[model samples]
Target: MAAPIDLELKKAFSELQVKMIDTQQKVKLADLQIDQLTRVQKHAKLTHTEITTLPDNTRLYEGVGRMFILQSKEEINNQLMDKQKTADEKIKELEQKKVYLERSVKEAEDNIREMLLSRRAQ
Candidate 1:
């Protein structure tokens, strides 16, 4: 009977360990996504500037030049905005996961403590 209870406790601890690892991985992925979004935003700004700086006399300049430039800028701005939104959402999710994982770890610790105390009492 004691052996079965010990085995069950060990399985529970093992499962918690796996969940902790998965939570850590999710946090790292979120951090990387945020970094990627920041870089993309910076690149989009630089590209928009380059496109705008083309002189009217330039051979590559096409019909409705100003309109084209504005459209391009708007597109880049929209992409950046989208990336930022995604990053923000990912970060929020990661924070929630971290909180939940922390709580789970704490609970596991409490369980272990209780088990030990019970053993000692016996």
Candidate 2:
């Protein structure tokens, strides 16, 4: 009886270890994505500032694949704003995912503790 219980506990522990590792990897990925998004947002802000300083008569040609489309300053500003907004949203989503993953890890740890306590009581 004790041998069977011990094997079961060992299996459960290994499974939990695997889950913890997977969660850690996911958290690291989320952190990396957040960092990239922040860098993108910063670059977009710099571009916006430079564009704002340019003269109205200066022609801005936005490259779209094989062609460059002539665009107004307002249009460029709007594009930058959109980029910034999208980056912000993606960062927020990654942060939320990190939080959720952390919460799940905590719960798994608590469950393991309870299981250990119950086994000891038995």
Candidate 3:
């Protein structure tokens, strides 16, 4: 007893559901990336602050994938500054992605609602 338009609407709704799920997943992944980058940025800032308080000649061991290499205070400060900058950039990128995904999700939901309303009125 369903009209052709109803069937079409249902199909569209299903597709939207799939899209919404995918978008939600993307948002979640972006949020996780943002969180990770934020932590890295904070850690880098802390390291920079603490390292500056140390004597200039103090030796520091830089960790490289489970191994530590000897480095000077200036070298460590430079590395930390670079890391902080990279983390800031990545966090900004992920935040933008998250905002876009959120907007898409909202739009999809609105379209689904409209379709359902139209079908009901038919």
Candidate 4:
């Protein structure tokens, strides 16, 4: 009700707004990362399946910056497995981060609501 309390409440509300925005941005980034990792994992699995069905003498190529170089089937398979593993790990991490960010955003919203309610009750 007092001037100081009112000013403090407004400041706190503003700070929470900023925090919520930042957390939301992080959530969006994490979602994008999760989607990318999912795509990579799917591609890796598909490539691995294709590799298995290919003939022994089949030629394989690895593309690098506008160039394609010959690669052994075994080498490509290993690389694909490694890539899939990395993507899986990154996806897990991003999912956890997304959950945390969602929680943070919810808490901030709740705090903002409480502040508004208190201001109205005064």
Per-candidate Cα RMSD to the true structure, in Å, reads: 6.1, 1.4, 2.0, 2.3
TM-score of 3: 0.85
For each candidate in turn, the TM-score is 0.53, 0.91, 0.85, 0.83
Candidate 4 local lDDT, 4-87, one digit each (tens): 877978798789889878887888888888998999999999999999899979999999999999999999999999999999
Model 2, range 1-122, lDDT digits (tens) per residue?
78887887888789889989999999999999999999999999999999999999889988899999999999999999999999999999999999999999899888888888988999
The best candidate in terms of TM-score = 2
Ranked candidates (lDDT, high to low): 2, 4, 3, 1
- Candidate 2 clashing pairs, residues 3+ apart or interchain: none
Name the Cα RMSD for model 1: 6.1
Candidate 4, poorest ten consecutive residues by summed lDDT: 1-10
**What stretches of model 2 exceed 4 Å from their correct place?**
none
Q: What is the lDDT of residue 41 in candidate 4?
A: 96
Q: In candidate 2, what residue range of length 10 has the lowest lDDT sum?
A: 4-13
- Which of 1 and 2 is the better model by lDDT? 2
Model 1's alpha-carbon lDDT is 0.65
Deviation (Å) of 68 in candidate 1? 13
